[model samples]
Target: MRILGLVFAGTSTPDRSQMADFLGDTLGLPRVEVGGVEADLFELPDGSTFAVASPGGMGAPRSVGFLVDDLDAAAADLREAGVEVGPIGENERERYLHFRAPDRELYELTERKAGIA
Candidate 1:
């Protein structure tokens, strides 16, 4: 399993511009706001993206996003392995399913959009 990115979600009013500035100045990350909400795409110095969004926007807090080659196959494998997986949802341009691990941590398996790598 590979982790593509981490999503930090909160209910507070998000400030995209401020976030962009902070990320660029402090963390030296490049940011791009893809939508009207507080959802922003952050390009880490290592070339990976860490997306931040309002709680009501992208996902819940502490949500772990996994990058999978095939969503259906991954989901099937998880189910066959006796994991309880949730239904898949359509995101901005991808399909993803959420599940809880034995420790109660939320995990997400996703088929990202083409060219995201």
Candidate 2:
């Protein structure tokens, strides 16, 4: 399982609206829509995604996701290493799985589609 890059980082705040203003207006990161919701997605020039959500929007307050060359192999390797993995999540561009790390934080491994970076 070869790790590629840090593809995503997200944090859930009780005041997402305020955070959104800072991210979009102050930082100048372009906002993208997620499932019809505005002001959550921000893409860096390098293609890494930073997201801010309401506390209830996700299961965890913070998440970090890495890019993996092979999702299935990584999942198998994680299981063999005794990691607790959650279900795989898929979108049009990528597939990802969440897992609990030794620190008890939830991290993600994503396999992007062929045409997507």
Candidate 3:
């Protein structure tokens, strides 16, 4: 499985509103609204995303997503190698899955929907 780039990074906090404010107001990242999820989504200049949300929103306290060209093949390869992979997650714009690393940290593999940059 070949990774193309870094797609996203997110962290959870108990104070979601304050963190959201800090990210948008202080950092000046462009805030976006994502339906069906309770989080403040910010789009970086490079088109990657950063999210700040309440604890438990993403199933991990902190996580990063790597862009992949083939989500299914990546998942298969990781599973064959005995990696602890979570279920596939889909939204309007992407498909993704979380996996546990050897160090027990959770990370994600993401495939952007066709026509999306």
Which has the better TM-score: candidate 1, or candidate 3? 3
Model 3 C-alpha lDDT per residue in residues 7-106, reported as the tens digit of each score? 8999999988898888899999999776655678999999899998788988899999999999999999999999988999887788999999998998
User: CA lDDT of 92 in candidate 1?
Assistant: 60
In angstroms, the error of model 1 at 66 is 1.8
lDDT of 1 by residue, 1-117 (tens): 445454322222356467656777888777655433346667565544566555445545546667777888889888988899999876465677888878887777878667754
Q: For residues 26-114, could you state the per-residue lDDT of candidate 2 as single tens digits? A: 99999865453322889899998888988856568998999999999999999999998888878767798999999998899999878
The lDDT per prediction is 0.64, 0.86, 0.91
Candidate 2 Cα lDDT to native: 0.86
Candidate 3: the clashing residue pairs are: none
TM-score of 3: 0.95
Judging by TM-score against the true structure, name the best candidate: 3
Kindly report which residue pairs in candidate 2 clash with one another. none
Worst 10-residue stretch by lDDT in candidate 2? Answer: 31-40
Rank ordering of all candidates by TM-score, starting from the highest: 3, 2, 1
